[model samples]
Target: MRVFFSTLALCLTASFAQAQCGGSFSGFVNGLKDEAASRGHDRQSVDQFFGSVRQDPKVIAADRRQGVFQLPFTDFARRLISSGRINTGKSKARQYDAVFDRIEREFGVSRGVLLAFWAFETDYGSFQGDFNTLNALVTLSHDCRRPELFRPQIFAALKLFENGDFDPRRTTGAWAGEIGMVQMLPQDILDNGVDGDGDGHVSLKTSAPDALMSGGKMLQHLGWRAGEPWLQEVSVPDNLDWSQTGLRTTKPAAEWAAKGVTPRHGQIAGTLPASLILPQGRKGPAFLAYPNFRVYFEWNQSFTYVLTAAYFANRLEGGPVFDAGNPEQGLSGEQMKRLQQKLSQRGYDVGEIDGILGAGTRAAVQDVQQQLGLPADAWPTPALLNAL
Candidate 1:
């Protein structure tokens, strides 16, 4: 009996050792190696790629701690689309007029819009992040939170390596695996990359024209309509119906004009379809978002971010600043989380308890404001949290 018990303990110890080894980071990478091989990637190359990768905790932390969605449009825009950035974009448009002219002629995407993307993505190529592309993508793929999204990106990166478009040792980018001056992901690099500089290779990191042309091609593929406005700042009358002040409702310019909505600068043609966006509620700036605005959302999901890009693009083209009054500051992350919790407790579907206040949270805030006889502008404030 003693011998049998000793043998059983030894077996259990071996089993635990095996489990620990299989659960290690190296083990996870090995599994990816096999998966890549099955997907027809060269085995030697896969091994070479995996050998150089180290899991990046900083990348994982950044993915989990994004707070940009919580910032108010005014604060976000003011920080990103400053006068310096606008002037730089304008100068770049002229400095690279030959390149921009060619890209626009080919892709039908405006130079200002492409420059806005460049400025926003990496400060006009001044900084394009420092994380290793392979490390970030592999680590993100191993994480279970969104494996489906990042796994394909890993394969796409591997394909880029195979095609000589990326070097695992030298390919560094955003924590989320976006590369180059315009901050495109590996999948986008494979799909929309263009050889703009006549180098016979699409090198977005080293070549400005390549990045710009690739970005322009992407925008064109994403349905950017030539000669269409993305959005314009506008004034909303106090007597206008508050229920129709969000992206969910759309109306012709004539209908909005009849309801006392007009451009802050000049009259808009009545034939255009537009939706009102009160980024800061009725008290702050408003915008009339046109159909071309959807293409901006396709580039970046944050309404505030897309709006900033569009506004910066317009500024690059010599447009005026918003005539609407400056927006009040938005809630901090802690305040936003508290508001989301309160809304959830009150039977509003604010989705996750994460601090980012997205469309669902905004809608819930609007419902609460309506119930409490408040202004119902859907904008969260300290007072709104206190009232709840």
Candidate 2:
């Protein structure tokens, strides 16, 4: 009787677990169907789209485990702009020289810059992701964390299907619904997709020319300057004021020159409106980011990503590597979390306590550094943590 009761309890637990999974996902899908239909999507199309869509726990897990934002700029940039990646980018550039020339002539964006974005986004299309686009988008839309952002993407995916641009059965991409060689979102595809190969259909996934041209078009639409340097590596003087070393403060090249900042390689003649960005802090490396650098922010909001993409583009053009001034080690995730908590306790709004030192957190750190009469580099250091 005891064994029979134990077996009965195990069976009940399994049945309950199965029921919970099926019921919760089914309800979420029904709600998504209603929402999509209300947003002017065809009811039949919405039903067909959501009918076979299963809840992807893997997508949710991937979203929660995004660690790239937590890494220091030096580490992140070094990994992405390695010697191997630079060689591959150059090879791709030479392989598609004619296509890039045409794209550059039409869009006025650099071929190397486009190649950098492609390499960074999906490793030159070698691994564009394998998650089903529809399932991923629908699952993300059902999630409560950022439903507003993902819902529109789901509608965009549906519209792509309606317009005969995407076949749902073969459409696979990143976990967040980004598709194609350059990992463009659904709305981006609809807005900036171009038929570079001129086959009458803009298939960015299979056509290299189409993806490259579409990326160029997207950058052009994002206000990429015709002929402007994105950023230049520079050496900052030791006696320079530490307060003037962030993206928030813009000064002319003449002003920086007056303060003893010089380009590492070339010359800074004109008074271009540029900002001094110390990526890893005052001790790491300094860069004079020009107006065109903002275009990279539009491509990706992460400062590390934008800087790495720009740096990689420059490397492809035979630019020199960064000056080695960064520290041997940076803060770990737990240390960063502790620093953020301390900042919050002192009334500095560091945004989330997620250990990722973003703009808000950096600004708060700068404030603390200023209060403590230290160099306001805005970078979290072990000494800074101890001071806090």
Candidate 3:
């Protein structure tokens, strides 16, 4: 009888979870609470953690409207890497000089890199975000569209709550459930969080040292190489093979130098394999993306954002402002979506026809350009679309 009852209970719980995934919002949250109890969390704590987690429709709206990523690289970078942001980053670097020094020594991550993320993520902790974190996480978890990506985060947040580090009702952050100054997700905090201020508690939201150091540790955990360059501005010769541009193709720095890919300022790692990325096109700002640049993708998957952050880090390290050349105008959002559809029809995996020039879309554009005898700079144009 005991064995039969246990089997029946398991089947019922499984069915309940399945129903919750796409059913009413209240049912979904109940499923989460039940699952927490099953996972060894005490019922009282689980109830406390989720008692007030109202679903945030605004988070769902923000998740669906990531249209800002469609902006051209020059415009995006220019908007993000403002002079004031740079000045503030430099000031923070000085203010937290000792913390940064310790971070570099312990984690093998750069201060410039951490400072750029700090400035960009929350403007040196001036604003971490305003959304109720528990609500956002619960909402996103209940959302069927990418539930797998967000569902686990709710449990991680619960662990923080259990530790007295999180307040379900009061803890606020980004709409995506990222908490603290660097905008880290809950799992990141659980896995890589550091208490840099020597204060037994890891106060990432209120302590600059904790935030910066924790950010550094997270980067290191993401496979950041010690003291190695991530991005370098470069001058690609007019005669250089445009087909070899884009991150899909990598060549030794020396091979690129032999082809007249000169560094605009700092020394290039001679033997290190690097990809030549023309963010706008061959005519626009060019950069050599080093091995460390790949790790930025682990932080944020958007190619444009990772590039801008890396470039800003370089600027913080005293690199010159990029010379934005006059590249041809790219496709509008709808046009780009149409282009993606065409590419998909042609058997190229452009990920989604969302109108964003993501890495997959760019790669598809490059392949089509090369096939059609175009410049193959990976910057989609109306000409290419018309040709398709």
Candidate that would win on lDDT: 3
Better of 2 and 3 by lDDT: 3
Output candidate 3 Cα RMSD.
Answer: 7.0
Give the C-alpha miss distance for residue 123 in model 3, angstroms. 1.1
The estimated TM-scores of all candidates read: 0.89, 0.90, 0.94
lDDT of 2 by residue, 251-327 (tens): 88888988889998788745688888887788888889988888877666666778878988888888898885954
Clashing pairs in 3: none
Q: List the residue pairs that clash in candidate 1.
A: none
Question: What ranking emerges by lDDT with the best candidate at the front?
Answer: 3, 2, 1
Order by TM-score, highest first: 3, 2, 1
| Residue 154 CA displacement from its true place in model 2, Å | 0.3
RMSD of candidate 1 to the truth, in angstroms, is: 10.2
Worst 10 residues of 3 by lDDT: 1-10
TM-score (C-alpha, index-matched) for candidate 1: 0.89
- In terms of TM-score, the best-performing candidate is 3
Regions of candidate 3 where Cα sits further than 4 Å from its true position: 1-20
Relative to the unseen true structure, what is the C-alpha lDDT of residue 329 in candidate 3, on a scale of 0 to 100? 83
Residue 166 alpha-carbon offset, candidate 3, angstroms: 0.6
